[model samples]
Target: MTGYLPVVGAAMSITEYDQHRDWILEKQRDLELQDFITADVLNGNWEHLAEEVLAKLDGYTGRLGIHGPFWNLDISAADPEIRQIVQKRLDQGLDVCRKLKATHMVVHSPYTTWDQHNLDQYDQGHSFKLQCIQENLGAVVAKAEDIGCTLMIENIEDVDPSIRVELVKSFNSNAIAVSLDTGHAYYAHGSTGAPPVDYYVKAAGPLLQHVHLQDADGYADRHWAIGDGTLQWPALFNALQKYTNHPRLILELANNANLPKSMRYLSEQGLAQ
Candidate 1:
């Protein structure tokens, strides 16, 4: 919405998109599709479904992003066989990106407090897990490079930004970067000792490529509209302006009904156009 960066909306499914398409078209906001492509992968027709979705969006001129298939697919799985499945899912996501000509794809991080608890399970559990992630994503990064799509690794259960930032830098590829989820950061801060939202912006800095902008009560990932929860919106915006202006800020609201309200909040606050 601003000259410095793009502000977008999130759609969890095609049905949700259809329900909110009028508002989205009216605003001409870009979108991040969460479960839309994932459902196609599960239903065994993502290729065809991707073409259908692309055709539907042909008249709607805006950038596109996809939240890849990350549910239960751990790229850093200890088992080699399981890791292969993870790689396959990511490859499928890349193929879908190629078809849709999506600008970004968000992948979930496998790190959690559980890794710290199971430290002795490996030589150095944290480092080993990071290595596993690097290896798995390294394979997919090549496809990402070939397709000219940027892969964003998002924080889910991370207690801090260090691990995710380290993972992104280790790739050292423009094709890969970091995706920060606001609600997840608050949830981690409340439950697992992660820092506040501004800390993530400062920590990620330039590597931060995309964001899932949702509000929460600091206990659960509520995914409410931007101003409806405990997050400090003004401070977060200032921190982002100081740290970087490159990340795409996406409003990932749970209920489609709240999308318009959330957009109005961003515009009224002068954070977006």
Candidate 2:
């Protein structure tokens, strides 16, 4: 785990099961990847497609992970009923993970209408609203564990690290963990290296399950090629390597985390195994 880095996998091509089956399997073996990532919807033959891919990987003993659906999912909803609906959407990916025997489920904790950026707009009930949001997220964590799958909280650039840290602390579930993103973390802070990736790594160390690797201009998520921009891969890897579990790296390049470009960049940078 320390010496050799794992090959990265792509999100399913075009959300189709049949089209991606052969390619995913081939990538798994050819690239020596135990981890395959997908942002595929839970419906529309996703399960069957996953089965086909898993069957192929079963030959090579590959592990699977999923990027849960993002549309309309509100894990931090202030309303209890709305939060339940969001939980169902997230559970879809977890359920599929069970069928495919996926090792982890990567998820996004995105913005709500009452975005924290607009905190000044809050009236007298701001404190109460924030409490509701936290409680619902905690509940989601419990529900994720009940279903017997790991829920990796995806990182976002704009949200405060304290929010993520608090969620991890309060959720306190074995199934709950983090899906750190290098680019997102970089852009999340207002200034370059203001809150270093190393800081978040240590804070979320216990919940660290996997990672999304990319580079950006520190203002937007450009998803640049490795080392093409300013992302510090060597230092990032150095910090990550200090951890006990060798977290799988997902080369989250543009469109999809394609293996071809990922391999090329890593090879050029002497990062390929």
Candidate 3:
């Protein structure tokens, strides 16, 4: 796998997709749609939006997915009512996936820095959290399986990298898998005393089915272009070679205009296309 340039792609909003339509369609690169991540889009009548997107993507053929709604929606909430809302939001995301024929949806991880420190203090604490997650996502997972979409649990505020890997494994379903966010992992490393970004790739191994490739300073989720931050792109790409999963490496940047710069940085380093 030495000198391997993995299949790289972009996670773009509908407008961004249109802006880069020619380049994306020319390369036939993989894509993760980001329009449905907002609450307004989820709560509104989005069928027309979906139809418009389908129309725009008429000639494109590539691996397609979407960033699911994760705003203030906790999939591991202890309260049944909160969990119901979370489930409803996720079900809506799946409906979008079904409409677009997407095969993956990126979801936020439930683990936190507090869970890293306190989950072991009580014997039931860890089990109870797992129970809550299972209860909340059981139906959603089944729907994902039925619709041929894998729900990728992405790391956010997670100090322990393996926590998400274990959580994904606990589901025992193919529809659930791990998703790594480079900026989020770097934040944990610099701000929370966790391991570096590459360790996360190693930890998730084959379970990592998707990735949000962003560069950051380890202070916040900067979502900058690949060379604009302090992350070790070479090391992370080196670690990625150990897995056979060939995960979807989607550039999830803050500014869609910087997509070319990001890809240029990776290509110059011989890391990705």
Give lDDT tens digits, candidate 3, residues 179-230. Answer: 9999999999999999999999999999998989999999999999999999
Per-model TM-score on C-alpha atoms: 0.90, 0.74, 0.97
Candidate models: Cα lDDT each:
0.80, 0.61, 0.91
Residue 120 error, candidate 3, Å: 1.5
Error of 1 at 37 (Å): 5.0
Better of 1 and 3 by TM-score: 3
Best by lDDT: 3
TM-score of model 2 vs. true structure: 0.74
Scored by lDDT, model 2 comes in at 0.61
Deviation from native of the Cα of residue 241 in model 2, angstroms: 2.2
Q: Flag regions of model 3 displaced more than 4 Å.
A: 1-3
lDDT of 1 at 109: 86
Clashes (backbone N, CA, C under 3 Å), per candidate, total 0, 1, 0
Which is the winner by lDDT between candidate 2 and candidate 3?
3
Question: Which 10-residue window in model 1 sums to the lowest lDDT?
Answer: 1-10
